[model samples]
Target: MKRAWKVSELARAEIRHGCSSNPRSLTHFLFTLKKSANHGSVRDLNVDADTHSSSSSSFDSSALFSNISRLFTAKSPTTLSETLTEDLAQEVAQLRDALARNLHDSDEVVRVLEENCGPLLRRFAGGSAIVHLLKQLDSRPSLALEGINELISVRWLLGSSFSFYQPKDFNYACKVLNWRRKQEDCEFPMTEEEYAKGIALAGKVEKVGLAIELFSEAANKQLRTTSTYNALMTAYMFNGYAHKCESLFWALKRDPNCSPTIATYNILILVFGRLLLLDHMKLTFKEIENLNLSPNLSTYNALITGYIRAWMWDDMERTFQLMKEGPAKPSTSTYLLMLRGFAHSGNLEKMEQMYELVKDYMTQKHNPLIRTMICAYCKSSGKERIKKIEELMRHIPEEDYRPWLNVLLIRVYAEEDWIEAMEKSIDEAFERKTTVQAIGVMRSITTTYFRSKAVDRLATFIKRAESAGWRICRSLYHCKMILYASEKRLEEMESVLNEMENSNLSQSKRTLWILYKSYLSCGQRNRAAQVIGLMCKHGYEIPMTVLPS
Candidate 1:
């Protein structure tokens, strides 16, 4: 009778014999390892002679363990604990390979690895591997942070000295949550920096409500610092709550613990600029000086941006002169903003001058600058537009040249109504998998095609965009339905709805309204009534004017 082999031995045997190539087989072995690791011992693994005979090519369990033990042959005599550690280390390397391969069930594999492999991880996995695992869980930041807490728990239970000292590891933790440990476990306190990073992460993921909750919690905990307040205010300002940002700024001023920084004033200026509160923006700039805070590059840029937004050419130029004289030198962003302002102001002379200045400061990585230059020329007249665009095109890096050229050509061709040229440019962008995020420009092109009743062209363009995974705006579908309704092509009209549904686009009040209007305009009162029913089903309040008798 064959002696009973250990679970780890069987796992190594299977992996060594091609089971690792099968994702399910790999997941099973990992699961087994996790179970055994958690139980503090490998279960006795047995294999029958018949099973072994069925796969004559397979290595026996003993042979696999023998190969692994040879790795430690040159070292001192190993104890059972050292042997277990070696086995756990090998499991970690396998986990890394499994993740790196990105199997179909890799996400599920990641969840299992995090939830079940804590002991093995604490024994063998280093900080970098933990960080990699966290990033692999990037789609779920909450879960990523929980993995860290799990490792911490395992460390405490094992009485191991595992610590996260790397900046990247700590920063990622902060981004997800303001985590703290008990007083006895080398406590990490709730801090303003932690709150700031957490809030920024929330904002980045568009979880503004969560950001607010974090800020409120910070206030309740009396962890309100200048950086924390600044971060929250920025989230508010960028998410179209500029008024809330202004109110927060005043509250920050009143709070004795939170002294406003230059960043705070910079955010305030931007808020005022966006709100068109030019007087308030200027007062804030003046207040910065009164507070004896030396204006930084960001301060001047914000002020200039405010001037540019309000179309105050004289003031923008004056501020630019001041920025040039002050300690804060202009950055590439300053010149790019100036270029846009000048182009819109129709001061091509000044635009060209700024373009030269921009080129001197800009690098190949400044693809946005190149796009802006092309857009600026598009707003101008004459062949010089093409000449300048081509000139700027030469400076774009080889890697970025194609995509940038596609966007630039789209803009130029769209402006000139070169339909074939525009379509070709768009096709190239999609083919290269660099679908342009120029939704507004695409809307304009689609609207042009729709208005002209170019149904074939419009359908082709929409199909191409959808195939390339670009989100088709709802308005485009509605407009198509309207066009089909006008033409009395009821079949195509309803097909638009089907397309929207198939794409997982939810029906909205506007969608129902469009359908109701379409059916009613087509003299199909019964279909119109069905749409009103859909509206009711969707919980949209029907307008009295659209109600059927």
Candidate 2:
């Protein structure tokens, strides 16, 4: 009788008052309804076919709510709040399920609604729903590939503005530029112009990979009277090609034009250090000492990260201590690598302490990602100890805060089920024009498109990226050519090869093989001969082939 009276009373509120406009009043009324429904001895109500049908029909819901309401009311008042919380949670869960079902079955409805949502829904779609929607359309064949192309094109143009960088921004900027460029042209070859741009970027960033390309392009063409072999050897070593580093080091020693530098020894030490081939590391260190080439800060960090990887924590600490006493002091990367290692090892205490120690420097250094990363970790663990971290960051001055903080804040609030919090952050961010960061924010989308063999989208992105000014031409070239081959587009590959030849962006031995396969795959023997002719026109040697009679 008590449960029946409570249900009728709650139904009476919904039928008359429904949910109110005022938040507090609405919360109370909703809470009352939840309590009334949940506190009811529901198992008995569900067991009775007539009562169950009558209540579910009244609520315009399924038997699920009826059954759960029974469990909540059967519990005591101390458990009442907990039980009511679970029952209320069901409202949100059902909404999510309904949204998903609508997206699955009502494409036209979602399409029309999402377009009007402006950028927020676009980000949500690109970030979450886009890939799933593509997968669903896979069996539709007519729509699947085109749908992905549309999704990626929108992604390619998604950002608001690309801005100037602080010192800490370079790493992230490079990652974004790299990701964006690859998205547009995973198989686009770096034009000689693009390679030149990369060389300029090397001067700015001191990225070892770009340095290797500069010397490789110079040496492969035998362009200068000056020796490039030593530079290539140094570059190969630094890039962690152990055998190539060793071979090139020996090759340079024999060549009169090139000689060893202290930087060379550091590279050699790093090459061996990374393998944690303790014997090789020691040998290189001993050799460097003999040659009067002192190990630098980076050399030590390399050894430390390597030791950490090998679970030689003692050696890692020893290396750290040695850095303190030696010519080199530890940098943030040295600490970040250690922190990541500790994190992987599941040492939360050490991770926390290291994070706190790095906090001030990371801020001064303008490394906003560390804070966002910490927030992610905290959220994953469901720890409210550092609740609303993104909100707290807003108190800092413009000098202290990064422009990307809004993006981070919205993402966190969305993931936390703090719907009210998410709405506020998102509205603020949109008003502030945060949609720009979502553009190519995910490199995985580009990777997915590449894997799926989408060339036009890749080409479109590369063109956009060039205008935007990324510096990873070699990476773009490597991927773009692969995309061509994947689609069995030989003429396109041939055209790129011709462009590469003209610009002097020499293809590696592996790249040449890919080109050859592209030619054969397209059944273009004559075009293949033309490629050989084109190569010979540039004085590149071609094996003479006898015509089969």
Candidate 3:
């Protein structure tokens, strides 16, 4: 027996209130009516029939019909016209169903929309109905692209904004490139610029697989131009596929149709430099000169970076000098590299010289550099360099309140016995809620105090950090215990464990291991056995290697 369809009470109540104002109800009602048109009886219109009919509500037929009659009579034209009347509603339903099935026939949708929908309807179409349709086809990007582009075209025909939707924004360009490769009779070929941009996006997102696919698609389509080749090579280099980049570079060089540009050689230099292949890196630079291509600022930076990484200091200096004499002068980045190189090599005087030159150009973006310079000064013996650190600290804006920088400053001040300065920095960080990322930063400060054996100070800092609402991690608590154990202050170590217990912290195997090691080191075999017993109680596996012979 064929199941007879009737209007669901939910649909009835919706229509009674004003089905024209509700799209779901309207679509449901229209779909129901269309289904009934093919049958003699409208038995039940359980709109979400697929979800099940038992959950649907029932309403008084007479009351619903009374309200619906008034609604239609009062505003028949206004309601029906605005809400996609019967004919247009059928078209939308068919299109949505077809799109859901991965059908790419946009002509019917576009035609129906262009003929029936006005500017207002077209504007709302993309965000409303089209979005729902697109959701069904997200895994199929080519279909999604077609749907979006066709709707965008409809909007253009209706005298709407032409540039409202950019296909590039969705990162679906790679899918389009792949799709184009399979099409034998190309209606419209993708340009080189589009392929280049798609490859660049792939690289930016660190998607090496997509980058390779896009490149191969372009290559198979015979659309491998210089721009596309360069983009692909860069993607490989930046994503740590240096060997692949090298192979691509050689291929580009041999390709009679395309020649390597200055940009291409720069990529090769960077690849070779990062791999610490200085001979190849230098050879690539020589090739750049041989080709009469002027080395850009990026080229020089890559070469210097390579030299620094390889610790070829003398050669790095000579290259910098040659760069200074050449057309490519040092940029802010170049000076930063020099400063960092000097800092690492303990050449404090030269580091200061480069700092002065670059400091004026340094913005908030260069905070990492400031931290590096401060660390370098702290490592040196001269107390006078403390003033240099102070000057650098002033450059960091108060509003930024970078937690990492605050913790670093605390370590510096604590090391110098400037207790007041260290406390002030800590208070500022806590009050500003900057210490929320406390684990890593707290470890840095704790490590500084532990290394100096400043037990009192370490305890005080830990107390302050906890009181300020920072979660005192197990590791931080372990640091304090280790410090006390090292001093052979067993009572204080026990007190720390009690504090942890009061805080509802549980002990782990590492905790037992630390206790066992500490007791054994202090020549207390009895205490080590107690730790092993506690491990057993906690259901932790006891390692026999820690047992006394």
- Point to the candidate with the largest lDDT: 3
**Overall lDDT per candidate, in order of appearance:** 0.56, 0.42, 0.57
Q: In candidate 3, where is summed lDDT lowest over 10 consecutive residues?
A: 26-35
RMSD of each: 23.4, 33.0, 24.0
lDDT of 1 by residue, 1-549 (tens): 122224333432332233112221111010000012232221211111111112112112321121112111111121223344455555645654554343234244446455534544344321223323322223233322223343344444223332322222332333223222221232123333345545555544445565677677667866555556666776676567788888988997887654565667777886687566899999999998898876766677667667765778899889889988988776555676677567556687888888787555454434444555565676677666766777876776555545545766776776666677778777778778867567777777777666677766777778888888775788777777777878888899889988899777777888888888888888889988998998888788888887766
Tens digits of per-residue lDDT for model 2, 1-549: 456445534442342221111111111101001112222311111111221112111221122222222211111112223323443344334433443344323343335324432332222211112212211221121211112222233333222331222223122113222322333232222222222223323323434554455555544643211123323443343344568868867765564543544444545654565455777876777786786656665467556645654667677678888888987776555565455445445466666666665544443222223443443354354456336364335445544433355544545554454545544654564445444334332233345445556667656655544444332244455567778877776567657665556445687655555665567667777765665655656666555561212
Query: Where is model 1 poorest over a 10-residue stretch in terms of lDDT?
Result: 26-35
> In candidate 2, which residue ranges exceed 4 Å CA deviation?
1-230, 234-242, 255-259, 272-279, 290-292, 308-312, 348-353, 363-385, 388-549
lDDT value for candidate 2?
Answer: 0.42
Whole-model lDDT for model 1 versus the true structure? 0.56
Q: Which ten residues in a row are the worst by lDDT in model 2?
A: 26-35
Q: Which should have the higher lDDT, number 2 or number 3?
A: 3
